[model samples]
Target: MVAALDVGGLGMDAQVSITARPEPISLDPRRTAVVVIDMQNDFGSRGGMFDGAGLDVAPIAALVQPISRVLETARRAGLFVVYTRQEHNSDLSDAGNEDSPHRIKHRRMNIGATVEAPSGIRSQILVRNTWNTAIVAELEPRQGDVVVSKHRYSAFFETSFDTILRAKRINTLIFTGATTSICVESTVRDATLPLHCT
Candidate 1:
C-alpha cells in the first residue's frame, strides 16, 4: 500500500510518498523470529507494577490470551520465539542518574516504591529476580525459547538481542506485547532501522 504522509513543518507543506506491502508476506520459519516484549507480571498482572502505580491494567491484561495464542502458533510453525523482559539490577546500578528524574516521578506517584512480593522478597517494581520481573505464567518461555533481559525500553540496547538475531539468521521479526507507546514501539522503531542485523 502506498501512503502519502503530510510532512508539514515550519510554515511549509510537504508530502512524502511511502510504499508498503499490501498483502501479507510469507515467512521462512528458519529466518523469522517472534519477539514478545515486556509482558512481565509487572505490566500485566494484578497487584503488579501497573496496579501498584495506580494505573488501570485492564487494557494491558487483555493482551495476554491473544499473545499466548500467537506464541503457540509461532512455535508450531517452527519460528524462533524471543521473549524480552524489562528489568534492572537489584541495586539498579545500570539505571544510571539520567533516569533519576523519572525515578523521582515514580516515587512521587508511588509507582516504583519498594514492596514485598508474595514470596516475601522485598523489591521495587521490575527489579531482577523479583516477581514483577518475571514473565506472566501463561506465556512463559518453553525449553527452546530465547529469553532476553533488557534494562531499557528498546530490547536491542546494550543487549545481545542483535547478536542473537544475527546468529539465528533471523531476517524478520514479529513483535507483540504491552505498552504500545513505550517498550513495544521503541523496540519496533529500533528494529526497523538498519542496525547491522547481519
Candidate 2:
C-alpha cells in the first residue's frame, strides 16, 4: 500500500517523518544546487506590465516567505543557487525573425503589454524578457548567485545552467518558485534528472 502524499507550501510540511522510515534522507552540500524560477514582477504581480492579468499572485507571494527560509538553509550549506528569467527583446529579431532562437510567439504583446497587453495572456505562446521579468524581491539573490536567461520554460534549454552546475560538480537540485503547474513543471520535465530538496 502507498501513503497519500501531502504537498504544497505548508500543506504537507509537517507530514514528513524520517525517523519512522527505514532509510533517512541525506544531502551532500557539495553535490546540491538550487534553481529558482520566474519569481519576477510579472508573475509576482507587484509592478510588472502584466500586473492586471487577473490571476492572484498572493499564493506565490506567501510561498516565498517559506521558500526564503529554505534558501537561507541552502546558503548555510554552501550549495549553489541559480535563477532563471524569461525575458526577450521587443524586435522579435533579437532572438530571430520567423525562425528566431528566442521564438516568442507574441513577442510584442507580452513585453510590457504592447498593444495587446490589455488582452491578457490569451495568445501567450512564448514569453521572454521585458522590464518586469526580473526575479521577485522577496527572495532576492545575494552576491555570487548565478543568473540565467532562458527563452524557453526549461532553464536547461540552450542555456548555461547545466554547464554551471556540472562545473561545480552539483548533482542534486533544489527547485523553488511560482507557477508550479507551468514553469516549475516545465523545468522538471526538461531537467535531465530528479531534483532533491526540502
Q: 30, model 1: CA deviation in Å?
A: 0.8
Where model 1 places Cα greater than 4 Å from the true spot, the runs are 1-21, 98-112, 119-121
Q: lDDT of each structure?
A: 0.76, 0.61
TM-score of 1: 0.82
Q: Please report how far candidate 1 places residue 71 from its true position, in Å.
A: 0.7
How close to the true structure is residue 22 of candidate 2, measured as C-alpha lDDT? 70
TM-score, per-candidate, Cα-based: 0.82, 0.69
Local lDDT at 126 for model 1: 71
Candidate 2 lDDT? 0.61
Candidate 1 residue-wise lDDT, 75-163, digit = tens:
76566899999888766676656467545544443444578776777757878787888898999899999999998789999999999
The number of the candidate with the highest TM-score is: 1
- All-Cα superposition RMSD per candidate: 10.5, 8.6
